[model samples]
Target chain A: MGTWLALVASLNGLAAGAFLLGAFGLLATRQMLGCVRFFRLQSLALVASIFLIAIGMRVPDLIAVALLDLAIKPLLIPWLLRRYVREELFRRREIDQLLNIPTSLVIGLTLTLTAYFLAGVLPPAAGAMGNINVPIGLAGLLLGAYTLAVRREAVPQLIGIFAIENGSLFAGIAIAPRLPLVAEMAFPFDMLIIALVIGILTRITHERVGTTRVGALATLREGAPK
Target chain B: MTLFVILALPLIAAIVSALPLGRKLAPSATLLAAVASVCLVGRAALTVAAGHRVVAVPDWVELDGLGALILLLVAVVGTTAALFSWGYIAREENSRHLRQYYANYNLFVFSMLAVPMLVEPALVWTAVELTTIFAIYLVAFDNTPEAVEAAWKYSILTIMGGAMALLGFIVLFHAMRFGNEPFTWAGLVKLAPKVSPEVLESAFLLILIGFGAKVGLVPLHTWLPDAHSQAPSPICALLSGVKTTVVLYVILRFVPILNASGRINVDRWAIIVGLISVGIAAFLILQVTDYKRLFAFSTVEHMGIILVAAGLGGAAAHYGAVYQILNHSLTKSFCFFAAGTTLLAVDTRQIADLRGLIRTSPIAGVALLFGGIAIAGAPPLAVFLSEFSIFRSGIAGQHYIAIGLLAIFIIVAFFGILHHLNSMVFGEPMPQATPMTPVHLPLSSVLTLILAGAPIVILGLYMPSFLHRILQTAAQGLAG
Candidate 1:
């Protein structure tokens, strides 16, 4: 490979690793702000990978997607959430998760490894430009799903979903860099709506239910549980 | 021209209804748009059913035999739900929340209509996700703690599923990118044979499991009963009736593509998931204490049957699948409307709480019982005809094991439904604790029921030859 191409590829590998690390950071974070911070950082890593892939592969549309990710994920979504959801919800509050940090990390690792195995099922032709991004991005995606499963707080669960979105786009840019820019542009707009809608929902849940501990929502269960 | 018109009507209604309008204005605007769209969709369906694909922009904006079927059902329900909402929401909710409800309702209908009209796969995914977002507000419109909680669970889980499905779509684009094909469903089927099976397999599984959560497939269906039951009854009609079918239609688009790819046992995947959903939801139906929840679980059961028929993989089976699609959407919506009326009369959702419904309000009691029987696949009903066709195809194909299990599950669900309906509709009058006083049923609500109920009864006895032709075309396209 040419030197410039090699450098981009290697830097993308670092971004992919940091991307997965951000997922792990989500699992490790205790505060709601910490979870959001990890999600922003994960999205940044995704943007980095997208940017590198855009320049290296000369796929012009991904550059736009990278900018959209940079603007939306790291900045706009959080700001929108803050504006809509009360400040108290984002206060340095610890989140109540289903599992402890250590156990969650172990499961996170297992999920990441499994994601690699899933990617390993593909022919080498599968990840033509994906290189390390495919497996690492899959790991990030799996870890994000894990984060969603374990997080009980509404905002943290929301962050977990964003993590999944970031992780998937992280893999997507490398795999389908040439997708139409219009389609790629729709992603940011879609995220804006998601943040707005979920932000409103979280606010409503907090106001009406007196808590955002949504996992305990058990009224509709069969047998009309006590 | 007509496609854009159909899409534009709901969007215009959404904006207009969201404005600070009088209470009647929002529902009126929404109902007008819905009824107008139904007329337009009827024309489109007829054209497509008569043998021409509807294409607005070749590969980008289009509809086909299968798309026409879905679009037609969504339009029909949108009209009835709009009418039903006119009475249900005005009577139950604060007048201040009325415009907001109608706005969200129109937007929800718009998103669903967009799903079948957009031929681009990624655009289709966006439309599907849009349905979830737009409907979240309506799901939580009750403003009760339980309602918000249901909306929260529904949105979070389904949005997660949508995210996962996003990855699936992205991977699918990568698979198709090199083939120089247009990324439409038709284009993908053509490209599938050349793509590596591993890539296609991963894409198929991702999309299936991702969309499956939204479709109320087993293991990801904890939210369906809660969300469907808690949403105001009109929204529940949309939720249980056509919403699940919309997402399932997206998943079914892949079955043929995977089959075209060759080497993947996609049928087994559908069958396994279908059977599990049917088996689990059948028992859940028996245990459900709430009448609305009983209908919700029945939705899951019917979805399983459709998926199984689609998986059975023959022209006849595919025909059964599409036929069930039509029957389920119409009858299930009617069931929810019935449940809504029953709620109107007795002011309780609990099956145990209702007694001597026929004496209290004959219209509601009769509608409830008829809806239950129809959805339970009683003979001479639309669901019964379609289900029997599925069994016929399965037996003809000699799939004895799957056919046997499906038959047993159907019977269990049928008895469970009848048991619940029987107790609620026809018991001795209770001591006058609350005196079983029936509220005055709304003219709009009664009229909505009548309008929606005709097809359930009529289609059972006889289907128009044109609809049969459309179903045949839809089946052929779905089964490849």
Candidate 2:
């Protein structure tokens, strides 16, 4: 490979690794603020990867996607979360994770490795411009799903969901950067609505119940212990 | 032109209904748009039934026999739900919240309508996701503690599912060579043979699990009961009847492509999941105390039956599946409408709290009783006929184990539903119940109930041959 191509590949690899690290950071962090920071970093890595791919593949639409990615994820979503954190309305400050940090990290690693194996099974997109990012993208997605499942607090769960969106976009940019303009633009707008609705719910929930922990949501179920 | 009107009318209604001057007029305005939707969708259905596909913009917007069938569903259910909402929400008399309610309600209808109209796969996914967002606020419309909680759980879980769906679509997009050719449903089916087996396998599994959660298949169905039970009754009908069908439509779109790939036993997986959902939800039905929740679990059960039919994967089974989709959509909506009416009169959704419903409100009690019978798959109802066809197809395909399991679950569900309805409709009035005095319903609510109810019986006894022929074409389209 030429020097420029090699450099681009290395840059993508670094950003992808950063994405994984951000996921791990989410599992390790106890504070709500820490979870949001990790999500922001993860989204930043995704935006960086999208930017690199846009320039490398010369896809102008992807460049637009990257710009929206920056605005929605790294900037707007964190701003929303930070506003929640500042209010300190939710009683639960710690993540109160369902799984321990170390076990969660190990599971994250296992998921990443499994994603790599899964990607290897598929025939390589022949002559694809980008190289070897699909595995990392899948890894990020699995880990995000794990976070969403394991976290007890609403904010951390929101972060987990954000991470999943980031992973999806990262994977999309790496592997299939040629979606129609409408489909490409829809994800970020969808993100904006998700963030907005979640923000409102979190506030409403905290105000009513004094905590945004979903464990307390059991009252709606068919049979609850008296 | 018809397609554009079908897609645009709900959206225009949504915006106009939200404006200050239109808040009082929201119900009428939305009702008009919904009526227009029915006419346009029926026209499109007729055109497709005549053996020519409706292709308005090639890959961007098109309708075939399958789309036409689903479009017909959105139109009928959307109109009925709006009609019911007029009576349901008006009595609440919270004018301040009515604007937001109608706005989101119309938007939800629009999203469901767009699902069948759009031909682009990614755009289809986007429309499905939009339904969740639009309806989340509606689910939490009452802003009660339980309402918010249900909305929160529903949104988070479904968005996670949406993420996986997005990944699945991205992989499919990549597999299709990044839209080098048309990536529409027809395009993908044509190209499916060339796509690698492993890629197809992975993509199909991901898509199934993702959309399965949205369909309220078991194990991922924790939110379904809660969301449906808590949402306003009219919206509950829409969610149970129309929204789940719309998402399932996305999954069915992939059947032709998966078959073409020739790598995966996609139907077997569908059948397995379908059976599990049917089996689990059947028992869960017996445990639910809320009348709305009882209806909600039934929704899950019927979805399982549809999946099982689709999984049987024969010409007969495919027809049964599509027919079941129509039957379940109409039947479930009518059931929800019944549950809503009862809840309105008795001022409670708890089954134990309701008694002598027929004594208190004959319209609601009769609606609940017959709607329950229809949904429980009794003879001479649409559900029973469709389900019988599914069994015939299963036996024809020699899917003995699946058929046996299905029969057991359907019987269990039958008792579960009737047992609850029997008590609620026939018992002596609960003395402690606040609304011991009989309550009268608005003429509009009664009319909408009849509008939804008559179809359950009429379609069961005799289907128009034209509609039957269209359903056959739709099933064939799915079977490829």
Candidate 3:
């Protein structure tokens, strides 16, 4: 392979690897602040990858996407989380975690390996996207789902979901340069609505039962008293 | 002209309804737009029934056979819902909450009308998601703690599911991008055969699971009962009738593509999920105590039956599925209307709390009885004919297990509904008089009953050529 092409490929690989690594760390961390930091790092890595792609393909859209990632992921979302943390005064660790940090880390590792292997098995229709970027994307999906299943706090779970969205976004960019701007715009709208709804639910939870822990919602079980 | 009118009328009405002047005129304004749109949709349906597509606004929006069928649904039900909301909200006008209720009601109808007409898939997603956001306010319209809670749960759960749907769309976009087509419905349909199987499989699964949540399929239907029970009666009718079915239409749009891809046996997966959903919801129907919830579970049950029909994967079953869609939308909306009226007179939704409805309000009692008989698949009703066709097709396919289970569940659920209707509508009156202001029953309620009820009666006895053509085209599109 040409030297320039090799360098571009290496940068893409490094960016995807960084995203996968940060996803694992986010899933492994017990502290909410720690999770936030890991997610910020993952976003930073995403920015770097987008920058590389823009330079390589000379596409302005990739650069625009990079700016969006830089603005929303590292800066805005974390600020929102910090403010929510202070206002809710929720310091107690989240309860009802389905798995511990170690087991989750192991699962995350297995997912990353599976992602890599699965990418190899896929028929290569998407050029570089089908071969390299898909594995990292799948890893991000698995990790995000894991976080969704295991995390007890609403904020962290939301962050995990954002990570999964980012992963899919990156995969789309890598595979198809002409992805519909409308669909991309819809993602943020969806995120904004989800965050708004979750914020409202958290406030309701605090007012009603004095905590945002979802475990308390078990009172509405089937055949239970009204 | 039709496209712009269909798209803009509701939105203009919604904005007008938010104004102080519009509040007084909201009902009439909304009813006007709805009636106009229904007439336009009926014309579009006829055009398509003649084997010519309604390509409105050129590339931006078009009505093919599938779109026409759905537009007909949105227009008919939307008009009825608007008419019902006039009286329904007037009854609440004495309360401080009436203004916001009318505004949200307008927006909700606007969103539903937009869903089936938009030709772009991404635009359709936006419209569908907008419906959910508008509904959040409506679900919590009463602003009680339970109402607020239900609204929150419904919004959060559905939005989360929408996130998955967005991912699916992105995947499909990528798949189509490589094949020299844009993200329009026509583009996707043209390029679907050449799209990679891996991408097709992932996209189909994601779309199914995501849209399935909105359709109230099993494992994602936790919000239906709460949302249905809490929302205003007319809104409940819309929710169960047009809203969920439109989402199902979105999912059905991809079935042909997935089938043609020759990758990922989607039929088996659809059938399996459909059967399980049908079986479980049927049992749960018997266990529900709230009348609205009983109706809500019935919505889930009917959705399962539709999916099962769609999964059977032939022209006959496909037609049956389409027929079921029409029957379910009309019958379910009528059921909600009746249930809402019953609640107004009885002042409670608890099935055990209602009795002697026939003594208290004969109009409402008979509506409830007819709705019950129609929804329970009694003979000479639309649901009976459609469901019988589905079962016959299933049996023909040697799907004995599915047919047997479906029969058992349908019979069991019917008896459960029958028991509830019998006790609530016929028994001795509850001791307390809940004295409610009797607002004049709007022409819409009577109209909705006739519009929905007449089809059930007419189609059961005689099928019209135009209706049969639309169903045939829709079925052909589904089977691909």
Candidate 4:
């Protein structure tokens, strides 16, 4: 039993490390499609972490939550995006960021460290697996917010928002593995709706503005000279 | 069962409105559903007011005094907005997809109704997100580039906030789990004392900033004026009037729970955050160019006031808070309805271009002026009474600094709003404008202005004993 527990904890640690890496990839990647790829990677890492944490914690409910994340985040959301978003969105690279890649990476590192220190403000995690999941999950969340701050295109920002959710749930799996199945069941469906709405919105924005670079779509502001 | 029916009515109406049966059927069905929901919700509120917790599914679906107040507000605004939309959208868009607009409208109403009805925090979060999803198309209904742009901003920002709030709810669940409580608001309050300060504080802060964005609190409120201005006016009425309040209702659910922890000064945080929103919104209202945007900023101000009142944390302040919530929702909807009629009459949103509307359209000019006075908290209006009660509560509680800042900001916003409305309603005619011919206002909208405006006028003069009881009960539930 001890060896099995050690195995699951170590695997959870490895998946969490990969999850942080995926978040960094999302921050630094120049291509919109690269953002999607990194997001999928992060989601897969999340599934692995949740599944391993379920095993480590002996919570069967989390296994179902992990499966739901697996199906929706990776498989279904991307498919819906592809179906709804224009083909050109994939081909076009979003080079215009509010900050340069190197600066963003440095800030991302700082944010990760900040997350580590911030997680100390909470009590010690419930288990060995939780110790790995909580701070790393927070880093993922902070990094996701950073990605949103820098990314200019519609799709990358949307994906950035997704990463933020992934970050929270990644921590949530370890922290509140026993959350009711009813609420857990709602998460994937909510994500599906978000993808659908954003997908159609991306299409509308592109058709109207002739570009998905939403940051450039800033006609509405206060005190514009009439 | 009635709670379940309140939840299901809007869903049924959405389907009926979506059918290709003529445009008349869509609005009729939507209005019918909205009115029915309000009736059911009114019944529920009376039950709550009479000291009964209406639990549809134990720990899953329930309505308390606080929930009932917000639900009733949403239903009322949803109904008026539906009625206002009948004439507003029919003439403005005249597009082939009018049925689609009503369908989306009904769905949006359904999503809002779900938020206060559901007892589970997670389900409530889902309902809040659904409100954004269902309303995105409505925000971009005109499909104009600017409108679509506003919709995109509205969806991304608020939904991003929703994502952040998801983590907060999880943290709350984590805190609650340590104490073996059910995962509901009532359960959290009961479990709060056993929870650690750091865990509960983090959860509270995360949800505060997360949902605060949707509530149009400052720094997160950049999208509010834009989205509120660009949506069709009836939708603006609903968005500004009830939706922000609906989201804030979720935040208020945390107050007693946090206070129950007996550690974190959640009231102080509420005051600081509320004051900042009110301060910033007051200044923004001063510089606002569009008429609709003016109301949007005032929304931020009103939200701040309620937060401050809630933060003060006494029975009187809590009463003031709920009263302000009720007054703001009603008066603001009327303000938006007036804005809608003015938009139809003049065919422009520019405050500078709207000169001497009294000469061109007396009904719209009078309505706009009335709306401005009522919303600005002038004499003999519902808003004035609520605002006065809050001031009295603050003074009585000895929250001198917050009261001072709140008083200053409210005055600034009042003058700012009335100044703009005054110039627009009673100024020199802009002859250079496009012929300045008076456009005939839509009949349904005219009816809506009269229907919605009556409450603003009547409530100010007479304090109905039942509503007073309801507000008192909601305040107690809030203060715990």
- Choose the strongest candidate by DockQ: 4
Report the number of the highest-lDDT candidate: 4
Q: Comparing chain B with the reference, what is the TM-score for each candidate?
A: 0.98, 0.98, 0.95, 0.98
Writing each residue's lDDT as its tens digit, candidate 3 over B298-412 gives: 9999999988888887777888899999999888988988887777666687877778888787777888999999999999888999999999898888888878988998998
Regions more than 4 Å wrong, model 4: B92-96, B432-437
Candidate number with greatest TM-score: 4
TM-score of each predicted structure versus truth: 0.98, 0.97, 0.90, 0.98
* Model 3 C-alpha RMSD to native: 3.3
lDDT values of the candidates?
0.88, 0.85, 0.76, 0.90
Q: Return the clash pairs for model 3, or none.
A: none
lDDT by residue (A93-128, candidate 3, tens digit) is 554577888888888888888877765433332445
From the highest TM-score down, the ranking of the candidates is 4, 1, 2, 3
Please give the ranking of all candidate structures by lDDT, highest first, separated by commas: 4, 1, 2, 3
| Model 4 lDDT on a 0 to 1 scale | 0.90
Compute the lDDT of residue A105 as modeled in candidate 2.
88
How would the docking of model 4 be graded? Answer: medium
Query: What tens digits encode model 2's per-residue C-alpha lDDT throughout B232-338?
Result: 99999999998998998888888888998787788988899999999999999998888899989999998889888998998999999999999999988998888
Residue pairs clashing in model 4 are: none
Alpha carbon lDDT of residue B200, candidate 2?
Answer: 71
lDDT of 4 by residue, A103-170 (tens): 99999999999999988775556677678888998899999988987888999999999999999888
